[model samples]
Target: MPDSPKEEVDETGGPDLISFADMPDRLEAAGLTRISKQRCRQLAEEDPAWPVPLDKALKVGRMRLFDWRVLEPYFRNRTPRQGQRTDLKPPATEA
Candidate 1:
């Protein structure tokens, strides 16, 4: 079966280098809603910060492409896992 134009192909199974300037329209047209273009640009810019907000990413530059897996969680709004709390430390592991 032929794929529809609305669906993007990532048979490469990896992230593709993408430009932030063009990412807004491509992402929008693909039906992927994001926090904002500015935030998208922040990811494009590879900022060194955790929990980057949408509006503060305007100072970014166009950069590389990323994989669907890499970006999926950002666009997909999900609920927090059950029985989880940040106040507690993760279970220690021995290797």
Candidate 2:
């Protein structure tokens, strides 16, 4: 099986794995839709809301506050992808 995340600590005391809670701010930050804490608490009750889907949305809007110190490294200075044709090419026609 694949190794556990860095945040996981085994009895052997190996390298600590990275966890969502310990992740950097940028990675933990929101993506597009922003949400409020009150809304997050509500979403937390729903499926696919609390962990990332909701958090990312709220983070993008810059609403929920977080400790970026550990989460910062996870994020990067990245720009949105260009709207280029990424579709797979169809098989070429025989001559």
TM-score of each: 0.37, 0.21
| Candidate 2 lDDT score relative to the true structure | 0.38
Per-residue lDDT of model 1, residues 12-81, tens digit only? 6444434455656666765765345676655545644323343433333543444444455554543323
Q: lDDT winner among the candidates?
A: 1
Candidate 2: tens digits of C-alpha lDDT, residues 60-81: 2434433333223223332323
Cα deviation of 1, candidate 1, in Å: 7.4
Candidate 1 segments exceeding 4 Å error: 1-7, 11-14, 34-36, 43-62, 78-95
**lDDT (C-alpha) at residue 42 in model 1:** 51
Per-residue error (Å), model 2, residue 92: 57
Write down the worst ten-residue block by lDDT for model 1: 49-58
10 residues in a row with least lDDT, candidate 2 = 70-79
Q: After superposition, how far is residue 10 of candidate 1 from its true place, in Å?
A: 3.9
